[model samples]
Target: MRSDPALIGPLLERIAAWRAGHAGLFVLGVCGAQGSGKSTLVATLAERLTQAGVAVAALSLDDLYRTHAERQALAREVHPLLATRGVPGTHDVALGLATIAALERGEAAALPRFDKAADDRVPRGEWPHAPANAQVLLLEGWCLGAKPQDTAALAAPVNDLEAREDPDGVWRVHVNAALEADYQRLFARLDRLLLLAAPGWDVVAGWREQQEAELRQIGGARVMNPAGVARFIQHYERLTRHILSEMPTRADLTVRLGPNREVLELMPGA
Candidate 1:
C-alpha cells in the first residue's frame, strides 16, 4: 500500500529480470522483522507477476503454526517458550520443503491456513490450484532464513519473554542448529533472495506497537497490547538481531526500512 513507486519499481524490476532468466521453480525468501512490511512487498510482487501472466503462488510460514492445544502441550513438556511461537521451531519446515518440492514438480498442493485469533492452524482442507503454468513461489516470514548467534554469546541475558519461558534459549538453539545444517539446503533452492533490512529492536518495537494499535481499533479485543507485542518481539529478538547483522553479508539484495517502517533504501548487498 505504499504510494511511492521508488520502492516498488526497483523490486519489481529485479523480480522481472529473475523470472525472465530462470524457468525453474523460483523461491524468493522475503525476510524482515515483525511488522516490517515483508508480506506487503510479497503481495505486491505476486500481484504484479500474476498480471503479467507469470503464474505465482504466495506461501507464508505463519500458515504452519501448530494447533493451540499442541503448542500448550509443547510448552509444558518440550519448553514453555514453544508457546511463544514465531521463532524458527514454530514451523513445520519439512512440510514447507515438501510443499516447495511439489510446486517444483508442477503439482497442485493443499495448504493449511493458520488462524492467529485462534492461535492454531485450521484444517480447512483448502487447496490452492497450482495451474500447469504457475511459475514463481513467494515464501516469506520473520525467520525465513534466520541463523542463530554463537552459543558462548548465548549466555547473555535475554528479555523477559525469553526468561519467563525459554530461559535456556532452547528454541533458538535448536532452530539455529537445524538451520546451520539444512537451511542452506533450502536456500540453495531459491533462485534469488530478497531481504527487507529492518532496523534494530527499538525500531521494530515501534512498528509492532503501531500495528497492534491499529489492529485494536479495528478488531477490538483481537489485537495484542504493548506488553503482548513486547513478548512476541522477545521470541524473535535473537533471530531479528541476527538478520540485522548477518543479512547484509548473506542476501543478494537488501532493502532497508526506516524508523517509520518505510522503505529507506534498496541497494545491492554488502
Candidate 2:
C-alpha cells in the first residue's frame, strides 16, 4: 500500500496478464538506484499481489553476495577492489541462478540473506525457506536489469574511486566483464523488468544519506558515516550511470522519478 497506485496498478495488471498466459513463476525484476525505494516498492507489490490471491516470493540480489572470506580470496587473486561488495564480480551468480532454478522446479528453496553489518552472507542453513509453487517471484536490485557497458567505456575513470584506487582500470573492467557473463545468465531469467529511474546520479548521495540516518536510528549495524556514503557510492557510479543511460528504453516498464523520488512519468519499454 505504501507503493504508489499509479505504478502498482499497472504492474499488477501486467503480473496478472503474465500469470494467465504463462505457468509457474514469473520473475519480475525491479531495478532502482540506491535509496530510491525499490525495496519498499517491492514489499508493497508483494503484499498487494498476495492479497489479490497470487502466491508471491521476494528476493534481493544483495542477498547473493559472496561471503567475506570468499571476497578476501578474490581480493588477493583478482584485484584489491574485489574485497568490497556491491559490484557484479563480488556476487555469487551461480547461486542466484540455482535458487531460481529450484523455485521454478516447484521445490522449496533456501532464500539467501546478506548481513550488511557483517558484510557477508548469512549461512545457508540459517536462510529462510521459501515454499514451492510460487506464481510470481520478485527479483530486485540496484542493477538487476542492467546491460554490460562497452569495453571502451571502462577505460575512463568515472570517479575518484576509479581514478585513485583503481588507477590501472582493473576493477571496472573486471566488473564489466562480469556483467557480460554470469550476470547476464542471472538477468536473463527475468520475465519482466521495471526500472525506478532516478532523475540523475546527483540525487543518489542525498537519498543514500537518508537511508544511513534511518539505519542508525534503527541501530542497523555497519552503517557507514555520512562521508563514507560519498566514497562508497563511487563503487556503483559507473554501472549505475550506465544503467540510467541504457536500461530506461530496455526495461519492460520504466517509472521515471524526480530528485525527490516522486514519479515524473511512466512509459512502456521500447
Candidate 3:
C-alpha cells in the first residue's frame, strides 16, 4: 500500500539490467492471478520509466477480450462456455501478436480498452509514435504467458461449469488445445516475462472480492458481486494454478505478493 518509489528499486534494477543488454522490442510481461496487483505495478513502472526519459508503452492483455456482443453470441450458439473469459482461447491472440509486431515496427495504432465491471470494450484513439525507440513495453494480464491445462487436468467442478454454458460442447478441450500455440506466439516477442506471484488461488478470491466491493461503491449495483466474482474466478481456476506453478520454472523474474498485494519478496525464475 505504500507508494514509495524506493520500494520498487529491485524491480527497476532488473528492468534496467535488461535494457543495458538489448534494444530490440522489449516485451515485459506482468503476470498475476486476478487482482494480484499486476496492473498497479505495470502502471507504476511505466510512469517511472517515462519520467526517467525512457519511452514506455503500457498494454493489458485483458483489453484483447472479444467484445461483449461477440462473446454473448458465441455463448448462445457455438458454446455458452465461451461466454466467460480468462482462458487463452477467449482472447484475440493473433490480433495481439499483430499489434505488438506493428508497435515494434513503429506503426501507429489505437490501443483497445475493456471495462471489467461492464464486461465490454470502449473505443479509443491511436497511440502516437512510441516516443521514437521506446525502451519498454509493459504487458500486464492475469495469464499473459499461461499454458492451457488439459481438460483432463481440470477439476471435476470446472467440468460442470463448462457443461452448464455449453452442453454437448467440448469447450474446455478446445480451449486447452490452443494453449501451446498462442503462448508460443506471445512469448516469441518477449524480451522478459515478469510474474507477480501469489501464494495460491486464495489470493485471487480475496482480492477479487475486495475489487468487487470497491466497484459497488464507485460504479454502483451494476458492478460485480460475490456471485459474479466467484463465476469469474471459475473461468481461470484450471490454468491459474498451472501458471502459478509454471511461472517459477518459466519466468525471468517473479515478485511474490501478500494478500494485501504488497511485494513480499523477489523470486528469480529457474
Candidate 4:
C-alpha cells in the first residue's frame, strides 16, 4: 500500500503537535486488522518523525508472542488451539509491560523480535536495543486496544475454527479473560491510539493472501499458502470484527481505509 502524503503529512503534524505538548514518553497505539498495513504505516510514521528530529521507537505486539516452547506447553495444558499465536492469551504480556516500562523510564531497552518463519523468538543476543531516550513510542498490532467480548457474545462460534476446535468454549473464554486482565493493563499505557479501519472483514482474507504471496516471492519460510491463510485468519475473526465495530469510537484517531488499503478518511475519536 502506498503512503499518501496528503493523508500522512497531516497525521504526522498532529502527532508532532501532540508530542510537543506531552511531557515524557508519548506512547501511541496503532490498531488494525491483519494485513491492514499497520506495520508499514508505523514504519513510515517513525521515519518521518525521526527526520523531523523526534526521537522515536517502534514495536509490534507480534514481537511479544510467547516463545514456541511456552505455547507448546500451553497447548498441552489448556487446549491444542493455544499452540497457535495471535490471541491475547498467547503473548508474554509481562515481558511487554516490562519493555514498555523500561522505555518510559528512558533506560536502554532490548526490544524483542519474533521469527515467524522459525515460529519462535529470536535469541536475546539478537534482539534490537532501543535508544535510552526515545521521545515517541509506536506500538502497532492487530489486537491493540481490543476489548474482551462478553461471555454471552462468546456463546456462538464466529467461524469454523471456533465451532470445531473450540466447541467447548474453553479456548475462547481463556482468550477473553486475558484481554480483560493483562492486555487491558498493557494497553492502559498508551497516550494516544489510532485505528486503521478496514472497510470490512470480508476483505481481510484477500489482503492477507497478497501478503503471503509477497512473502513467498522473498523466499520466506513457513509462509502460509492460500488455504492456510484462510484458516489462520479464523483465529482472529472474532476480535477483528470486534475492533472494526468498536474501536472507531474508542481510538484517539481513526484512519478509515478502502479494500485496496488506500486511506479514505481520518477521524478523531469520541
Tell me, by TM-score, which candidate is best. Answer: 4
- Per-model RMSD to reference: 2.1, 1.3, 2.6, 1.1
Arrange candidates, best TM-score first: 4, 2, 1, 3
lDDT of 2 at 38: 90
lDDT per residue for candidate 1 within 1-270, as digits (tens), equals: 354587777877887777786877878888877888878878888888788888788888788666788778877876767776676556666767787888888877665578787677766665455555458888888777766568775665567766666667676577667667666566667777778887788888788888889988888656787888777767777777778888777787888878876777877865
CA lDDT for candidate 2: 0.88
What's the CA error at residue 211 for candidate 4, in Å? Answer: 1.0
Residues 120-162 of candidate 3: C-alpha lDDT, one tens digit per residue: 7765553334455556788888888776666556434444455
User: Which lDDT values do the candidates have, in the order given?
Assistant: 0.74, 0.88, 0.74, 0.91
Candidate 2 Cα RMSD after full superposition onto the native fold (Å): 1.3
Off by over 4 Å in 4: none
Q: Model 2, residue 150: what's the lDDT?
A: 84
Give the per-residue lDDT of model 4 (tens digit) for 1-270: 447885688888889777776888999999999899889889999888888887888899999999999999999999899999999999999999999889989987999999998999999999988878989899999999988988899999999999999998999999999999999999999999999999988998788889899998998888888889989989989999989998899788999999888888999878
lDDT of 2 by residue, 174-241 (tens): 88899899999999899999999998888976788888988989888788888898898898989888
Instruction: Write the candidate numbers in order of decreasing lDDT.
Output: 4, 2, 1, 3
Q: Could you estimate the TM-score for every candidate? A: 0.91, 0.96, 0.88, 0.97
**On a 0 to 100 scale, what is the lDDT of residue 181 in model 2?**
93
Query: Roughly what TM-score does model 1 have, to 2 decimal places?
Result: 0.91
Q: Model 2: runs farther than 4 Å from truth?
A: none
How does candidate 3 score on lDDT?
0.74
